[model samples]
Target: MLYQNFSKTPVLAAAATSLLLLLLLSSTAHAEAPMAANEATEVVISASRIEMARESSGSAITVLDSDYLEQNQVQVVSDVLRDVPGVAVSRTGGAGAPTQVRIRGAEANQTLVLIDGIEVNDVASGSEFNFAHLMNLEVERIEVLRGAQSALWGSDAMGGVINIVTKRGKGSLNGKITVEGGSYDTHQETLAINAGTDDYHYALSGTLLNTNGISAASEERGNREKDGYKNATINLKSGIDLLDNLSMDLVVRHVKSDVDTDSFLGGVGAVDSDDNTETEQTSGKVSAKLDLLDEQWHHRLSFSANDTDNTFFTAGTESYNSQGYKQKYEYQTDLFLYSSLTNSDDLEHRFTFAAEHEEEEFYNKGFSTIDRDMDVSGYVVEYGANIDDRYYATVAGRRDINSLFQNANTYRLTFAGWVTDSVRLHTSKGKGIKNPTLFELFGSTPDYTGNADLRPEENSTWDVGTEYHFNALDGYVDLTYFHTDVTNLITGSGQTSVNMPSDAKIKGVELSLVLRPSDNTRLNSSYTYTDSNDGNGNELVRRPEHVASINGSYLFSNDQTRLTTGVQYNGKQDDIEYDANWNTSTVTLSDYTLVNVALTHQLNKHIELFGRVDNLLNEEYEEVLTYGTKGINGMVGITITGSL
Candidate 1:
């Protein structure tokens, strides 16, 4: 009954049709030469906090490498992840507005975000990360792991995890400079520097962005003032090879941005509220790693802190600010139990153990300082193995003890194996937990009081998928099914915040296909279908039932020149609308599609030119009910790069 509004045709039909088109496109290709070997798979760290190949991880994950980011001319982190499977991104306005991201129909706060292995979710802001304020500066790669990861990442990981890795110097004397400008009076500039040798490394980068000529409120809402935004960011990553078996690393990131936002209530004879918002966030991490026993054992100790302050200035006397602080200490070790169990090269075993302590605090500007603090201690253990040549398995467990609430335990088990030489299967089941945020637990006023006896949220998740590789076409296809049941959902009514008695159930299917018929051409298609309910016979807000995307790229003239085109479709869904009388109504937001194109050319090894256009059709649609979205925008830039 969840999908009562959808058509009689099953959603899988759409995926089948798309795959047929890709197959037809591949059939017409007759290669003049043998296709090149598949690119080497990059290592990902979010799956288990250890480097591993994606094929053997036994989890659903997506990685965007530096090369792919440069090819698409991506500047913002959200822009690169907007169309990923089982993920939905919505924002209130342009580049600097508040943005919300949901995974697999989970709430925004259910996902955990990490920058270089340091948690960045604001404890005072409902435990969510603002994607609009995150720039892709000096980023080497991004790893998105879907489904409940509480067993590995703890709280705020009930939905998934997003891990970002920054670039590090690899050789002596290397750098890049980029400048870009386009529609909406927008402009950007970035500079990067790196230098070192195998014994030491260091990198520094900075970026500036400014944009004007867009209203925070939609044109349909009859707003007329142009809202502007400004952003500045700096990043640093340095490391020293102190000894033969030990190293020290330091990473720092800082971002400051200001934006004109909208805080309006729509009804009869309503007016939009224009306001100015500013935010500053800084984070630092220092870690030391040591190898012992002939490289059979490894240990890492780290300390990190993330600080944030935000302000909102309104037209009248109503204004507010919040300051959030977090600190963490962690230690982890890895032991290679067995590197060679048999004569073959496919047998291995690894064991991991970890411990962490974290503290959080928050304050408010207008009201008296809440002065609330809480500490949590967590422990984790994991085992992974590739048994024989046909099977890989991972088992993990974690326990958390909070000073304010009761203890929690979560576990996960996963398996991946080959049914045939060309076909493989994967499945996983896990439990998840999320403790209440600081503000939700202690920042209530006299009229709206916080519940002292609140309980942590909990969930159970399971997923199964299969992958098939077509050697002739040099392509692959993947399909997965997932389900989740969540309980102890917290809800805030007008007067107080409390845990709701009802539960939520969500399920979905994800499909992805890729084909490379020739050395110069590639095709990709992906689709997702989700159905969720909140136990009140109402659909979850902002959760679309259908989403799909298509991508194609071609190399022209030479290998140095390439063109990429893509389209994304988001289906209609229901959202809650509150009237002036405090009555709620469910409304249907129309479906919409986005088109994008990008091109890159290399004049020589040291210089390259790139350009991209987003929302090619300029489709005017709202991701959030009354929020305005950027119409047509483009950027053209040139890059100079080299290593000596």
Candidate 2:
């Protein structure tokens, strides 16, 4: 029942109507493609591993630059992505809790995450990324690509990809420092330094965060104890010009965190006790880039490694503990060839060839019967072209050889072009895959058992969209319709895991808008409508039918002061609830709305002050069924930017 039954709910009806308006508005517009407010063109990679202008990007992509992140006072990586269309985010509890990122209704594990050029997804688990500890102190930009990307990125790209690019040093010496404090006994400190000369450059940063947070469970659940969290992060980047045309660089990141948690069994929230967990992640990448043929040809070779260690302690048991660790390694090479097209006017072609080999090693004292090691190898080739400065096309294919699943092939074809000066159209289709995790395929215990016979989960996705650029209004609007079909989905039935007999279908429409009415005023809005159902036509869990967000900000005092307001609305969704007997049942959570506000002012060229208030209305809402959310909390801080 794809959108046919949305008339039953008033909110759904309104969303459907808005989608139609978006279609009509974009289809009829004529004039010129919208330009960025800064009037500066941006270059992006992640679409095909080759840099291209944003307007020529083949996939639906969103870029969050440093300025935007700063204006929003974003603390974590997930905060920067909450307003993007076609994406969904949920957390189990407070700041240090686990977070799940979903794109276009696909499962969380079906998404791939990258830091610079290194993949951060835990291969031994469900291939999911935990954003709780991923601070944003040193990040320069974040790129989010929505759709099936496995054709170029391999497994776990079935939903999409998130590429995090950190800051790099250039030119002269400079530094920044920030200190913040807020409700719930929260405090934070950040420092960043950069220095460079013609031959060498370096950037270094660190962050310290501590908070005596609210309860992990809802206040009404009779849980009164607080769960505190503390974390420290460090990032270092260095580059050297070995020769005029060749450069070498290294990126190192480390994070350590401790979190106090609440234990809940059978869908009930228990009070916080001695249940605490500590995690440490260390990752590094070393690479060399060579420019040949007057910078027309580019070659990059990189090697990266990521290691994580975690320990969990139970209440009232000093001798009982569980620990796990993972080590991942990757080697990659990319070669790009750029050439001009003779037949097409002012057209350019970029051909890319890439190869990768990765290995993952995991050990857990909590699980005794799981595999300890796995390996995968992949190869890819892609061709992308910009035709006559208005048309863009891309085609790519990949082959992945898995240790347990033998081999899989993936491919993609995408295109984008301007229908008129102001109206643009885009569409793409791709294939993706996700292999079974160690717990799903090898676990054997009284409460749960694995299925060695399970098949790899595979999917095909397609999307079409139109965008209208309103140069006069200084804004743009986009509407996209997407559909995904997945087969061999693995599910749990009681104590055992098995593949579903049929397939699941997820279809949705997304609408996004950005407006800069004045030189110092900006507004952003997005809406998403999703219909996700299982093979039997039952609504899937946590896939909300409607999600919307709107944010507006204005700068005064010659752009030295800024004030922002925001709102988020989340509609009802289905979730699973377990009874005391361990029986599972579906439940629908109520809809909710949250409001937030922020203020910032510059005291001088070297000093600035900022404050933020989240959940301004103190609305009691939950992203996860039973997890608690912060209410009516505020933070104030000052930033120092200058030559050290």
Candidate 3:
């Protein structure tokens, strides 16, 4: 009995290595074709509250599908999490630059970006979220949720949670269009549509991207003073089922981007070059579900709104603009119970309760402008259990109150066990918080000064895992280990009214695998080992201790053409450390391993043809901290789907 009523240890070393990897994956299932059953797809289970997969453990999860984002035409969501497994992405300019990402090791406003489930984090950068004005055109899937979720979302989430789910209405009118161009002058365009009418459903998407960056320090000729970027996006969604238990859904999104850098001149005067940065955002949401006094009692309601604007230019020393707004309301309930206590067998339990209210406002202008407003309230309760299919348990708690600062509490505990039927085991622990951003407390002008006494940044996390599934073959595997400890941790001493204090620690180990090995071919691999330390030992800049990725896919004729390839590695790092007065020199950055390939052809069921090649050994990297990251590129596209 796995995890039967908390932990008492058992599970015989993960059930004898999952029966020896399911007998080494049953001699390779005739070489391919399987995994196509699961209620015909469509899973959005936000971690422990139900819905499970990715082998299921309790923490550490990653999922990206939509034919792998249309066979890698990925235009955001940070390029599909850049091979997951302890993600980290950085960019300074190309497709509208200003992109930064992090997970596991946290930092990037401590991770927490959501769409559909709302919360886009960014009210004067309290937890960073620009996402270059969002663009992934009506996504259909993307869920990371690695660690410390504050019991179901609260504050910055302390480092993990990316949920983004879009696209509804399945069956009937479908659509697609794509275009691409390569080599520093890159160009892209996309459009999508989906519709249904059994009770009303809809989806819409639009995208446009432009690039022109290359050299920042390569003898400076890859496009001198490169400055050229642009982006645009629009998304809309709808749903209605009017009766039969009542239902409704709606969403709207908009984005704009622009960037042209060249500032902070040390050579002085005239060389100040050009500078312009702009961003605009809009968001809306509404949700309702009811079945009042039946089916275990159900009721759900939601409302949301978000608006953002940012502008920066320096042609004459002072030009800045900032604006932000947010509003939210929510309610939830669901309960089901039946227990007999006494460990080891099956019982029953499912309970949930939720309530939330939020409001935020901000304003700024020029060299410095300030104004503030905030209100937040929260509550959550959960319990889940299963004693007989091999054991499982969950407990959750959360409480939040804020008018400005301090007032947080979070808790979570989870256990899982299977021991047989393919093995399973899980463990989780949590606590989280983050708050402080409104330009870090007034001052976006006035020469920068506004700290209205700030405080609020804490975290604690622990996770352990194991998973193995093989109904005789079809392969699957997972392994996880995590630890996080953060306190205070907020920095911004690059000038402007200074501020500092950072204490951090992150531990990690992750490995995942998928294998078909033969009916055509498929093999995936992942590995990550991180230490991320900086509580005085110095050295946590541009982190990278080890990272790996491997991917392969193959399918032919009778199965309709397919080919995929991947290889990524990052190791050497330390972009800047040693600050006598403030980093008095000591920079090292040497680490590169890039290879990517993709090809798809199906010209049959409605046309298809694709191609991709990026940094295919054309290595020359720099993920930020001096910018510049590009070399070797290629793209080809074609797509068409039908059914009207």
Candidate 4:
């Protein structure tokens, strides 16, 4: 039933036209050549909890820099993740609606998210982070590492890791202010300031957003009510040098939001109602670092805490509330075991050791009062070696002791080597474990129950990939194949949760290309094919079988103006449908494509004008079964930059 009418002719034609125009305009332009394999030295931090050369790491990682984020001009963080190779994003409705991100067909909670080194997952809501309230106002960089990573991170790392690093102050005092307004009576304002010197640095940023959104239910179904949302966020980052060899850093963030929601009926799905949700999130982290022995030995100690409160209202009265609190303490050390440099060869060996303790508490108040808490202690060790800058290997192991579940031990191995001057091969194998969330073990509601006997899910994954660098084309191509097998799959049986009797399997292929055809033009494209099956040989819900995207940018007019365009395609997928009696059955969602364009012009050194059109094609689509999506819409704004 799926893919019967799927067509790619329209999207391919559009992409071809755009590329032709780019080539025609850049025929005579001259620019510096792209960096070669040996000359490139980008560092990735999330793969090993420390900075390592991207070319030497075996893990698949996608790094989005500040420039890329600025060019996209997206307000929500999840919008940017859609361009990553293995990520899938689903939003129930418009902006501020509940959103979920899955990597490689894994469950939403299986992915680990980190912001400024702090874990912000909600312990009371199945240990998953909601992307509805996560804005991209102060992000400097994002690192997406895909694969099983429990050997490095304790839990919730079966799918992958998304690490976001915020901007830090540097140089003289500088700041920026922005204001924008768009369709659906939407408006946003942002302010940021930063100042730093050799010994001290700090940055502060804030954003406010308000939108009169569309209906959460499908408009075709005759829903006419307009839901609204409002959000405010503030962030601060600072660091100070206590001594020549010691330093300390601090990070704090606060977010408050309120969003109107709709009710869900058994047969009718989403229906208009005077329902809403209010959420407050606060998180902070402090860390100290010390270096000795000619800066070869490093040690760090850190403490982090996160608190979240959510209140759900029915009609005009508050019906339920939940709170989640988490605290973590950790210490880690890195040592250089050996190092040697020669004209012909360079070699190095390193070791890392870490210990962590974490505590979580969940509380819910409604018809039934529930309170639960859990603690975990973990230790990890890793060794890495690089031979002649062409061969790399890493081995790691971890031991975790849980207060409510069985103890777990995990391990990982990776290797990367250059097979030729223009080709490189990389592979990794790892094991991961995710403990049952507090809510799944003790939570109780009118429609659902919890089972304390549920077991933790376990996964084993492996991936092999190769990279080819084209010197003549000034581009690179990457292809990878990945597979994962998961045992002890957790699912809901009637009203309570239970472990599946069979195992789940997932396999996928990813291909990506990047080309700097000209100094003034850049192009990027990616395609993914996924085949996922549940224990009972049924396709997983919301996991599309095929996805593709193409994005390009062109700069002209004395390098003062830029034009960018992008297109994304999502193939047909399955979703669960409920009848009047709450019986569930599978339904297929039609495939759709979306087009977007953005432009920016620099008026001067201090003032800039920017605008973007989303859903330019105005194609009707649905990411979720009954969720409504916005049509063609556009927004325009101005930015002012100056020194404080």
Candidate 5:
């Protein structure tokens, strides 16, 4: 079955295979010159809760920097994620619609999302973070760490972690203003400012967006009413040096959104309707860091909170509302036991200890009034060693004490080493857990019931990969194989949710390549082959067996003009469909290909102009059954940057 589905996109598959073979053969070729000196050492913070060189971490991670976001003209964060290997994105409708991201075929709720080190999953919605309102206006970079990670992040890390880091103030006072307009009566305006000094620094940004989107229901299915969306967001980050060894930082963000939606008819799936939803979210964090023992020991104390409120209206009448709140207090210390530079041996050792207490509350008002709260405490310990910067190893463990359900313990082990100056090998093995959400345990509605007997889902995963750097092209190629076993899968059956008795299996291979054929041109590409099945021998829904993407950028006209292009392919996948009688049947959604292009020109030192076209090929596709997707759309914008 997987082979048949993969064969559907023979062209894409063959191209990806050819590229993989080419890179593999090139790895054995001798380079004419050494690696570039300016090749910056990429550092990852989410992999271990501290900064570590990317090559030193065994986890499969991908980092998308701000420059990439700007070059791609990305507005929604999910748009960029689709290009990542082993990650899948599904949107129910158009922009601002409900969106879900799955990693390694794991459930969406099992993927942990972090914003500047603060968890932001929606408790009222089953511990899932909606990417609908996650714009890239103020984002500095995004780190997608794959595989099981419960040992470091605790619950909801069964799939992986996506950490979003926002920009911080630095250098002189500077800012930028951007305005854009496009098809579907869409327009957006954004402003950002940053300033920093030796003692204090601050960064602030705001964005407003409005769009008369397409119908949430498929237009081809006789739905013509247009659904619209509106959003407003604000973010602020500041830091102050309290003392020579002590410093404090604060971050706050707020978002408000309104989206029009369609109704689901019993036998007809989705239809035009007078329905809408409004959501408001606020999140904040404060932390103080102290250094002791001549900077060998570091301590951090922090508090963070996230709140979300959502209301739905049908035919302009109140229907239902929900609210979710979460707060956490945490303390962590890192002790440097030994360093190669300080000791005579060529080995270094470090230890980290952390403790956290978190509380979550969920409330709903509709057919049934549901209010629930849960708390958990967690402790984590980790040991890491580096031998002459050629070999690295880490062992981490965590114990969680929960107010409800069974207590859980998880651990992870990782190893990475340099095989040659241009080749590296990395691998990791880990266990993860996801506790049942309050909505799944207590909430009840006319169409569904909660199952308090639900147990937490458990997952075990492992991955091994190799990276080869081509000194001639100033690029690299990476290949990895990963597998996961999931037990006690929580799923909906009839009117209530239940944990399946069978274990699910997911395994995949990922291939990625980067090449700078010339100083003026660069290319990036990735391919993933996944095989996912439930214990009952059924393929998971919405998880394509084969996915591939290619993106390229070119600079010309005296380095003042840039052109970027991207193409993505998604293989056929299974989905569930319901009729008027609520009878469900499995269906295969057809494969699709999307093309996008962008052109930007630096008008001057302080002014820039850009234009972008999405769905350039106007391909008709459905990411979710009965959901409408936009056709070819275009937008033009201008940006102005200056110092205050």
Candidate 6:
């Protein structure tokens, strides 16, 4: 009966299709090159917490520039990540059913999300950030690190890291405004403004979104509801020139969102939900970078705090509230020299040292949930040296102490060599760990209990890779193979336990290529093959066996108009089987492929028109076995800008 209650909606579909057709018909098409110029050979900055050439490291990393974000007309940060290799994004129930992102077989808590060099992962839930309510209008670029980095960032670096850089002031006061509407009564709006002066610079942005829930299941009528969500963000950054060589910068950011949904367990109907949840957050950080020490030495000091308060009530029932908060502090120093040991062969050396501390607390009322409080402190030391521009090596070590764990030690070794001007090879190995969060130790409902005796998960990983860059043609390709083994996995039964036989392993390969033929058209493609399993040979839930994506865009050399299309494939997965109400069952999740298309036209100097189509085939699929995903959808938007 649950699967037999699917509903059909066509008006929204028709509007989305019409908008796409009109935009495409009005634009001129062009041929795409095998790769994009400069894109394929671009170096990433997130891998080592600093800028470095892609081929100069053993790890795998991906870069997403602003052009890709604009062509897709995406309003949320999560939407922009769909094309990353080995990364999967899923949304359940509706726009706010709690989104989840998995990378390379790692669980949600294993991955780390950074916004402008700041960690955004929730310590209470020990979960990767959903980014469901984060607006993309403020993003300048995105860098993804695809391997373990615990030696540098401490726990939660086992899965990898995604760093988002915010837009900065360039030459003038730049800003834009975007508004969009589509099916399921979805709508979005965003605004950004930035400016700079000889002595001061700053940028500010805000965004809002609303949508009606789609069908939760094939035939469920009432399961499909509506969500009214609001997100507000304010960022202020300023820099002051103190002396000829010294400057200071201050950054402050605050974000908050509210989500409303229907409760399926409280009632059975086609258009109502009795359950409600609201999540709100306020976070801010201040950092200062000092270059006055010397031309070769730099110093940075920063402090940040994040406070989250969440509440849940069933069917107009009031009596429960939950809260979570985290505070972090960091200091770093770096020394760069053109010639360290000697001035011969144009050799160079760099050294870095950093210290950090964090405090996290969780509290809940009106339910059987455990309250958690933790304090963590860590330090890192690293050194890198390059000789004759042909050989390089890096060594790093870290030590972390937490209230829950005595001390965790990690280390990394990296080597790179250039056999030829066009080819390079690299290798790296590192140790990492993921610590337990508050929710895992003490969250409760009618069916679950917390485990307080859990230990941190530990892992060691190694990666090898090669890159060939034909800079002459602005083309490049890279391939990497990685393996990770984890132990002391934490799980719940009557209580939490640290078990070695419960460990897991993951092996994977990644390939990325980019080409630019004539400077106006660009093509980028990536593919991943992964095998992940537990000691008992059970497949990890929610992870696809393989993933592939290709994105192509065309624009007139003048950069006035552009069109883009992409395709993604998520392989089939084994379902989760467990005892629910004394019965056990299994469900096989079907694999699915999706296509997306988008077009943008610069209609003069002050306005732009854009449209996009999602799930082109109207395919129905689930991200979490029996969970739900949105069906075919489309949206049309307009952006306006002004300069003074």
> Model 5 off-target regions past 4 Å?
1-39, 339-345, 445-447, 517-519
What would the TM-score be for candidate 2 when compared with the true structure? Answer: 0.90
- In the range 379-428, model 1's lDDT, one tens digit per residue, is 88898887764688999999898888889999988899989989989998
TM-score pick, better of 2 and 3: 2
User: What does candidate 4's lDDT look like per residue over 1-644, in tens digits?
Assistant: 11112132222333344335434533432232211235354567778888787778899887777777788787899987888888888998887899999888888889889999999888867889999999997898888888899999878887889888999999899999999999999999999999999999999999999999988877867888998999999999999999999999999999999998888887878888898999999999999998755556677878889999989899879988888898877777766544447777756666677777788898988678999889887888898887877898999999998989889999989998999988989999999999998888887665567788889999999999999988776777899999999998887665578888899999999898887778888888888888988889988889998988888888885898999898988899998787877677889999999898999999999998999999999988889988888889889999999998
Model 4 accuracy (lDDT, Cα): 0.84
Model 2, span 1-644: residue lDDT tens: 11123234233333344335434533333223322112354567788886666678768887777867777788888865778888878887788887888888888888888887777776434567788888897788888888899988888798899988888887689999999999999999999999988899999999999999888876666777888899999999999999998999998888899988777666463455667777788888888887654455556766677777666666734322222233333323333233346754655555566666666665544435344556676777787776776888999998888888879999998999998999989888999888876556665443466677888889999999998988877878999999999998777776677888889999999999988887888888999999988898888788888989998888995778999888888789887777766677888888888788889999888999999998899988778877788888999999999985
Instruction: Tell me, by lDDT, which candidate is best.
Output: 5
C-alpha root-mean-square deviation, each candidate: 12.0, 11.1, 23.4, 12.5, 11.3, 13.4
lDDT of 2 at 157: 90
Error of 5 at 308 (Å): 0.5
lDDT of 3 by residue, 265-363 (tens): 222211224676777888888887765323444556777777878777766344778777776676665544454566645365656667676777888
Alpha-carbon deviation at 384 in model 1, angstroms: 1.0
lDDT of each: 0.80, 0.77, 0.68, 0.84, 0.87, 0.70
Model 6, 1-644: lDDT tens digits are 11111122222233344335434532332222111113444567666655676655666777887877877776676776767876867665556666777777777678888777667776545445766656675777888776678888878787788878787665588888889999778888888888887766777777777776564432334244455555666666556666666667666667766666543321221234465667776666777766522345556667677776667766657546667777776766655555435556755666677777777787766455557687777878888776766787889898888888779899888888888988888888888888877766665543345666777888878888888876775777878888888887664343232444677898898787877765788888888888888777877666777878888889976688888888888778765544433233345578888888898889999999989898889887777543456778999999899875
TM-score of each: 0.90, 0.90, 0.31, 0.92, 0.92, 0.87
lDDT of 1: 0.80
Residues 99-198, model 5: lDDT tens digits? 9999989889999999988899998788899999999977888999999999999998989999999998988999999999999999999999999998
Error of 2 at 211 (Å): 0.8
Clashing pairs in 4: none
What is the lDDT for 264 in model 3?
A: 36
Candidate 2 local lDDT, residue 190: 98
